[model samples]
Target: MTVLILGLLLFLGAHSVRIVADGWRSRTLARLGEGGWKGAYSVVSLVGFALIIWGFGLARQQPVLVWSPPTAMRHLNALFTLLAFILVAAAYVPRNQIKARLHHPMVLGVKLWAFGHLLATGTLADMVLFGAFLLWAVLDFRAARLRDRAQGTVYPPGTASGTVAAVVVGAVAWAVFALWLHAAWIGVAPLGRTF
Candidate 1:
C-alpha cells in the first residue's frame, strides 16, 4: 500500500505538471531545449511507470474488497474500453472525425479507459489506481481544452479514409490487448472469465 501510494504520487505528479503548471513547464522547456526537456521527461515518466507497475502488482496480491460490481457492469466496461481504444487510435491516425471533434483524443481515451476499469473492478487498489487516473484525465482534458481555446486552436477536418483506418486499427489493437496481453501481463483475463 505504501509503495502503491508513493508510485501513484510520483506518476500522477509528473503527469500533472502540464495541467497544473503550464507556465513552469514551458519555461523549463525553453531553458532546456526540446531534446533536453524530452530526455528528462522520459526518464521521470519511465521511473514512475515502473514504480506504478511494481506497486500495483504488489497491491493486487492482498486484495481489499471495496464494493462488488454487478455482472452487467463487466459488459458495460468492455463496451467502454472498446470506445476508449477507438479514441486512442484517433489520437494518432490524423484527420479522423473523432480527433477533429475532440482535439485531445488521448486524454478522452484515458478518461474512458479509467472509467471502464473502475466499473469492472471493486477493490481498494482498483479504486485507488483507476479513480486517480479518472480524476487526473478529467482535469487534464479540461485544462488542455481550455489552453487550446485560449490559443484559438482549430483541429483539421476529418477524412473518411482516416476514420476508417482509425476504427480498424483501434479494433485490432483492442482485440489483441483483450485476448492476449491483458491475461498474460495483468494476470486477469478481462474477456475470458468474469470476476
Candidate 2:
C-alpha cells in the first residue's frame, strides 16, 4: 500500500505540474530548451510509471477488499472502456470531430477509464489507483481547457474519414485489449474470458 501510494504520488505529481504550477513549468521549460525539458519530463514520467506498476503489483498481492462491486458494474465498465479507447484514438487521429470538439480527448479518456475502473473494482489499491487518476484527469482536463481558452486555441474541424478512422482504430485496439491483453497483463479478464 505504501509503495502504491508512493507511486501514485510520483506519477500524479509529475502530471500535475502543468495544472498546479504552469508558471513554474513554463519558466523551467524556458530555462531548459524544449528538448531538454522533454527529456527530463520523460524520464520522471517513466520512473513514476515503473513505480506505479511495481507498487500496484505489491498491493494486489494482499487483496484488501473495499466494497464488492456488482457484476453489472463490470459490464458497464466494458462500455466505458470502449468509449475511452475511442476517445484515445480521437486524441491521436488528425481532424477527428471528437478531438476538435473535446480539445482534450486523451485526458477525457483517462477520466473515463479511471471512473469505469473505480466502478468495476472495489479494493483499496484499486480505489487508490483509479481514484487518483480520475481526480487528476478531471483537474487536468479543466486546466487544459482553460489554457486553450486563454490562448485562443482552435482545433481543426474534423472530416468524416478521420472520424471513421479514429473509430476503427479505437474499436480494434479495444477489442484486442479486452480479448487478450487485459487478461494477460492486468491478470483480470475484463470480458470474463475463461482462457
Candidate 3:
C-alpha cells in the first residue's frame, strides 16, 4: 500500500504539472531542452509505472475487500469501458466529432475508465488507484478546459470519416482488451465474474 501510494504520487504528480504548475514545467522544459526534459519525464514515468504495477500486485496478494459491487455494475463497467476507449481513440483521430465537442477526449476517457474500474472492483488498493485517477481526471479536465477558455481555443469542425475511424479503432481495441488482455495482464477476467 505504501508503494502503491508512492507510485501514484510520483505518476500523478508528474502528470499534474501542466495543470498545477504550467509555468514551472515550461521553465524546466526551457532550461533542460525539450529532448532532455522528455528523457527525464519518460524515465520518471516508467519508474512510477513499474512501481504501480509491482505495488498493485503485492497489494492484491492480501486482498482487502471494501464493498462488494452489484453484479449488474460489471455490465455497466463494460459499457463504460467501451465508451472510454472510443473517447481515447477520438483524442488521436483528427477531426473526430468526439474531440470537436469534448476538446479533451483523453481526459474524459480517463474519467470513464477510472469510473468503470471503480464500479467493477471493490478493494482498498483498487479504490486508491482508480479513485485517485478519477479525481485527478476530473480536476485536470476542468483545469484544461479553463486553460483552453483563457486561450480562446476552438475545436475545428469534425468530419464523419474521422469519427467513423475513431469508432472502429476504439471498438477493435476495446474488444481486444476485454476479450483477453485484461485477464492476461491483470489476472482477472472481467467477463468471467463468479460473484
Candidate 4:
C-alpha cells in the first residue's frame, strides 16, 4: 500500500506540473532545454510507472475488500471503457468531431477510464489507484481547458470521414482489448470470455 501510494504520488505529481505550476514548468523547460527536460521526464515517468505496476501486483495479492459493487457496475464499466477508447482515438485521429468538440479527448478518456474502474472495483488498492487518477484527470482537464481558453485555441471542424475512421478504429481496438488483451494482460476478463 505504501509503495502504491508512493508510486501514485511520483507518477501523478510528475504529470501535474503543467496543471499546478505551468510557469515553473516553462521555466524549467527553458533552463533544461527540450532534450534534457524530456530525458529527465521520461526517466521519472518510467520509474514511477514500473513502481505502479509492481506495487499494484503486490497489493492485489493481499486483497482488502471495501464495498462489494453490484454486478451491473461491470457492464457499465464495459460501456464506459468502450467510450473511453473512442475518446482516446479521437485525440489522435485528425479532424475528428470528438476532438473538435472536446478539445482534449485524451484527458477526457483518462477521466472516463478512471471513473469506470472506480465504479466496478471494490478494494483499497482499487480506490487509491483509480481515485488518484480520477482526481488527477479532473484537475488536468480543467487546467488544460483554462489554458486553451487563455491561448485562444481554435479547433478545426471535423469531417465525416475522419469521425467515422476514429470510431471504427476505436471500436476495433476496444473489442480487441476487451476480448483478449484485458484478460491476458490484467488477468481479468470484463466481458466474461477471453480469446
Candidate 5:
C-alpha cells in the first residue's frame, strides 16, 4: 500500500506539472532543453509506473474486499472501456471530430477507463489504484481545458473519414485488448463477462 501510494504520488505528480506549475515546468524546460527535459520526464514516469505495477501486484496478493459490485457493472465497464479506447484513439488521429470537440480526448479516456474499472472492481487495491487515476484525470482534464482556453487553442475541423478512421482504429484496439490482452496482462477479462 505504501509503495502504491508512493507510485501514485510520483506518477500523478509528474503528470500534474503542467497543471500545477506550468510556469516552473516551462522554466525548467527552457533551462534543460527539450530533449533533456523529456529524458528526465520519461525516466521518472517509467520508474513511477514500474512501482505502481509492482505495488499494485503486491497489494492484490492480499485482497481486501470492499463493497461487492453488481454483476451488471462488468457489462457497463465494457461499454465504458470501449468509449475510453475510442477517445484515446481520437487523441492521436489527426483532425478527428472527437478531439476537435473534446480537446483532451486522452485525459477523458483515462477518466473513463479509471471510472469503468472502479465500477467493476471492489477491493482496496482496485479502489486505491483506480480512484487515484479517476481523481487525477478529472483534475488534469479540468486544468488542461483551462490552459487551452487561456492559450486560445483551436483544433482544426475534422473530416468524416478521419472520424470514422479513429473509431475503427479504436474499436480494433479495444477488441484486441478486451479479448486477450486484458486477461494476459491484467489477469482480468472485462469482455469475457459479456461474451
Candidate 6:
C-alpha cells in the first residue's frame, strides 16, 4: 500500500506539472531544451509506471475488500471502457468530431477509464490506483481547457470519414483488448470469456 501510494504520487506528481505549474514547466523546458526535458520526463514516468505495476501486483495479493460491488457495475464498466477507447482513438484520428467537440479526448478517456474502474472494483488498492488517476484527469482536463481558452485555441470541424474511422478503430481495438488482452495482461476478463 505504501509503495502503491508512493508510485501514484511520483507518477501523478510528474504528470501534474503542466496543470499546477505551467510557468515553471515552461521555464524548465526552456532551460533544459526539448530533448533534455523529454528525456528526464520519460525516465521519471517509466520508473513511476514500473513501480505502480509492481506495487499494485503486490497489493492485490493481500486482497483487502472494501465493498462488494453489484455485478451490474461490472457491466456498466464495460460500456464506460468501450467509450473510453473511442475517445482515446479520437485523440489521434484527424478531424474527428469527438475531438472537435471535446478538445481533449485523451484526458476525457482517462477520466472515463478511472471512473469506470472505480465503479466496478472496491478495494483499497483499487481505490488508490483508480482514484488517483480520476482526480488527476479531472484536474488535467480543467487545466487544459483553461489553457486552451487563454490561448484562443480553435479545433477544426470533423469530417464524416474521419469520425467513422475513429469509431471503427476504437471499437476494434476495444474488442481485441476486452476479448483477449484484458485477461492475458490483467488476469481478469471483464466480458466473462477470453479468446
The candidate that wins on lDDT is 6
What shift in Å separates residue 22 of candidate 4 from its native position after superposition?
0.4
Clashes of each: 0, 0, 0, 0, 0, 0
TM-score, model 2 to reference:
0.98
Query: RMSD, each candidate, Å?
Result: 1.8, 0.9, 2.0, 0.8, 1.4, 0.7
**Segments in model 6 whose C-alpha atoms lie over 4 Å from true places:** none
Q: Please report, in order, the local distance difference test score of every candidate based on alpha carbons.
A: 0.89, 0.93, 0.92, 0.93, 0.92, 0.94
For TM-score, candidate 2 versus 6, the one ahead is: 6
Q: What is the TM-score of each candidate against the true structure?
A: 0.96, 0.98, 0.97, 0.98, 0.97, 0.98
Across 91-142, the per-residue lDDT of candidate 2 in tens digits comes to 9999988998889999999999999999999999999999999999999999
Tens digit of per-residue lDDT, candidate 3, span 1-195 = 989988998898888889899999999999999999999888888888888999999999998999999999899999999999999999999998989998999999999999999998999999999999999999999999999999999999889999999999999998888888989899987877322
lDDT of 3 at 76: 92
For model 1, what is the alpha-carbon lDDT of residue 26?
A: 97
For residue 99, model 4's alpha carbon misses the true position, in angstroms, by: 0.4
Clashes by residue pair, model 1: none
Error of 3 at 66 (Å): 0.8
Global lDDT for candidate 4?
0.93
For residues 1-195, could you state the per-residue lDDT of candidate 1 as single tens digits? 777777788888889998999999999999999999988988877787888899899999999999999988888888888889998999999899989988888889899999999998999999999998999999999999999989999999999999999999999998888888888889888887533
Q: Report the C-alpha displacement of residue 153, candidate 3, in angstroms.
A: 1.2
Estimate the overall C-alpha local distance difference test score of candidate 3: 0.92
Question: What are the per-residue Cα lDDT tens digits for candidate 6 across 31-94?
Answer: 9999999999888888888889889999999989999999999999999999999999999999
lDDT of 1 at 121: 93
